[model samples]
Target: MITQQRKLVTELPGPISKSLAQRRVAAVSSAVSGGSDIYVAGAEGAILLDVDGNQIIDFGSGIGVTSVGHSDPRVVAAVTEQAASFGHTCFMVNPYENYIELCEKIAEVTPGDFDKRSVLLNSGAEAVENAVKIARAYTGRQAVVVFDHAYHGRTNLTMAMTAKVSPYKDGFGPFAPEIYRVGMAYPYRWPTGPENCAEEAFADFVGQVHIQVGEQHVAAVVLEPIQGEGGFIVPAPGFLAKLVEWCHANGVVFIADEVQSGFCRTGAWFAVEHEGIVPDLITTAKALGGGLPIAAVTGRAEIMNAPVPGGLGGTFGGNPLSCAAALAAIETMEAEDLPGKARRIGEVLSARLTALATQFPQIGEVRGRGAMMAIEIIVPDGSKAPDAALTKAVVAACIRRGVAMLSCGSFGNVIRMLPPLVSDISLIEDAMDVLAEAFAEVLG
Candidate 1:
């Protein structure tokens, strides 16, 4: 087993990793990018073992996919057992108990006391696409509403829904039509102020939907309960609830894209719980299948069943192995109380990040729930301009020092930390130590 501690045997992107990078440049497309140059050989808990025999502490959690930690024993056992039995019978062709059981579990755990139904998919983009399909089918409407800085997925339709242009949307033109963009209640960057952001943004959002899209033609209003890639930006209080109420009143199916903030990453089964809002449709992925690939759209049975049979499914929508892993992962989350664990992790992270903010004015803000947290980097010149270069420098420095981190946000100025829920507090502290050193070195 790999030790859950940082160990530097060689410089990052050491000889072996450098050689692999050369090979990768020859074999792989230049379009594909990665967060680090270090090639990973193995991972366990919150530590990744690079090909050069270095143990780097993980702060990104594979962009929040390994909430249960890498290769969790329970998930591994379940997948192994299921794979040995049968790999892919195609749940659509020959139904299996695991698929049915996993859906049952999803219905049980996802928010809502109503009779819920779920359709499993292969990725978060697929789930969002299906959610829109179901909502349109149910409401007989066409327009879909999304917010600024939202990241639905990478598919064509999802690209239309996403806010960023340079990486996700550039040159991917002629996107799906009838996708309306709205302003989010981003408290930190709100012009008026955080105190007035909720009400004002809500009004602007509703006004835009009413005037631009016509509420009657809206099929669904999709949003991340807490925007993830958008700098982990938590909207002002009452913002989400107000939107939910408006969607309900306007006959729009509210879809909560909990793809990044779902499972135990946000201290709740879903981040919408924090706002006490139960959406009509919720899309989930990332941490859902442990480290395996599985996504789901679980919601009101009436809405979910609106799509005719054979309308919503794919060849590998709910693979048997993925279902087994999801079941075991959910079981582990319940058994280990990962949600509570996430809250504790949040306390530690919030304290440390707040301290860092006090020390470095370049840290414009630190925000997020549970284990999902981030620090926005900015110029200390009082203009609050995004400092993407500084952010990149800090993250690269940390990675070089045996701590893996990731930078996100519209401006690419947010250092997002998503450590595994099972990571030790001491491990987190050590990683924070590295982060502080990097910040000091870069800012000085």
Candidate 2:
């Protein structure tokens, strides 16, 4: 097994990785962007072994996909065992026990005491699309409401629901209709102030739905408890609960897109649990599959069953191998108490990042829950203007120094950290040290 440590044997994207990059430029579409040119050979725990014989610390967790750690033994073993028996046998055509078992596990963990049902899918986008479909079917409404800075997916309907435009929805015009965008209770950038963000934003959101979309015409109100690609933006306290309450009262299906905040990434099974809100439908992916391609929309039985037979499902929705991996991942989460581990990681991140902010005025704010944390970069000119260039420089500096980092936000000025739950505290501390060095080098 590769040692779990950061060791740069050669420059990042060394000979082999450079060669792979050249080949990729020739074969792969330029449309598929990546964080770095460093090609990965293998990964274990919180370390990634690059093709150039470098072990880089992983703080992104494959964009929050491998929460149980890369190549977790349990997930690998389960997938291997299941693949040996059967790989595909469309659940809709020929049902399987593992599929049912995984759904049962999802229900037990997902926040809700009411009986729930689930429909497995292949990706987060697919799950979001299906969630909207189910909500429309149940409510008999045409409009779907989403918040600003929210990222749902890349599908036509999802792209319409998503807020970003540059890469996700740019030029992909003529999107699905009946999608309405509303303001989010972003405490960091709220116009009035952070203190009034929750109540004011909630009021604006409700008023917009009432005037623009009309309450009765809305099918669902979809949101990420902690916005993902939208900079890990954690909505103000009471904002989520108010929205859920309004959704229930107005007969709008509340869909929580927990793709990035689900599993143990947020110190809870789902970020909504932090707000004590039970969504009518919850779309999950990313970490749920333990690196496999699987997503699900689990929610109330009445709403889920509204869709008639043959209304939901895809050819590879619940592949036996993916189901096996999910079951093992859930088992690992429970047995290891990864939620508590995430809380500890959050403590370390909050402390280190908060302290760093004191040294670098460019770091405007530090916020997040559990391992899902971020720092918004701003110009030190006292105006708090976004500093995308500085953000990019800091991330590049960290990558060159062997700590893999990722940045995201509406203005691309937020540095987000999502280290694996199994990462050693010492390893995380080392990564933070590298981050501080990168910030100092860039700012100085």
For model 1, what is the alpha-carbon lDDT of residue 393?
A: 97
**Model 1: CA > 4 A from native:** none
Question: Candidate 2 on 292-382: residue-level lDDT in tens?
Answer: 9999999999999999899999999988999999999999999999999999999999999999999988899999999999999999897
Each prediction's whole-model lDDT (CA): 0.93, 0.94
The C-alpha local distance difference test score for the whole of candidate 2 amounts to 0.94
What are the C-alpha RMSDs, in order, of all predicted structures?
0.7, 0.7
Give lDDT tens digits, candidate 1, residues 156-214. Answer: 99999999998888887989999999998999899988999999999999888888889
TM-scores for all candidates: the values are: 0.99, 0.99
